[model samples]
Target: MAIKVKCFASMREYLDLSEREIGIDGIKTVADVWRSVAGGKPMPENTLCAVNQSQANEEFTVNSGDEVAFFPPVTGG
Candidate 1:
């Protein structure tokens, strides 16, 4: 099975990606997804994460065909 991953805002620039499809084997949690996609690069501090558009945490479980998204923290005046 496979999962879709999305990077948004600064996360896109940092990871040099907007979206990708990854194999889900052995990938359990959101943190595992990060480790797989980040490719040894540590996840950015306080990076926001979600699954299927709903807010989630690093500990969140992930399943095949899930859409996982990562975002850099947003700031406004």
Candidate 2:
């Protein structure tokens, strides 16, 4: 299955691509998707994730049409 990924902020630079499509087998959690995309480098400790704009955890199972988003942690004054 193919998952649409959107990388933001520093994460985008590190990965060297803002958006891309990846193929994974079976149903995998959001974290699993990250690991696959990151190669050997793990997902950032403070990364925030959303599945179709809703907050998603590592254990959240992903479907073929899901929009998996990854962004750096947000901070405000």
Candidate 3:
């Protein structure tokens, strides 16, 4: 399956690109995909995850059509 990964803030620098498509087995979870694209580095602490625009988790199973966004936790002004 192909999943869309969007990196934000400092995370974008790690990837050096804002977005990319990753192909994975059907059994993979959100965390699995993140690790692969992250060069084996775990997602940053306090990172926010959303699948298809709804909040999700590391264990959240992804589908081919899902769009995932990873962003640093936002703080109020």
Ranking by lDDT: 1, 2, 3
lDDT of 1 by residue, 1-71 (tens): 79999999899988888999999888999999998989788887789999999999999999999999999
Q: Tell me the RMSD of model 2 versus the true structure.
A: 1.9
Give the clashing pairs for model 3. Answer: none
Q: How would the candidate models be sorted by TM-score, starting from the highest?
A: 1, 2, 3
Counted clashes in each candidate structure: 0, 0, 0
What are the runs in model 2 whose C-alpha is more than 4 Å off?
A: 75-77
Deviating ranges (above 4 Å) for candidate 1: 75-77
Candidates 1 and 2: which is better by lDDT? 1
**Candidate 2 Cα deviation (angstroms), residue 24:** 3.4
Model 3 alpha-carbon drift over 4 Å, by segment: none
Question: Could you tell me the lDDT of residue 24 within candidate 2?
Answer: 62
lDDT of 3 by residue, 1-77 (tens): 58888877877886665888887664367887687678867666788888888888999998886788787776669
Q: Tens digits of per-residue lDDT for model 2 on 1-77?
A: 58888888888887775888878675488988787778778777888888888989888999897888888886668
Tell how far residue 32 is off in model 3, in angstroms: 1.1
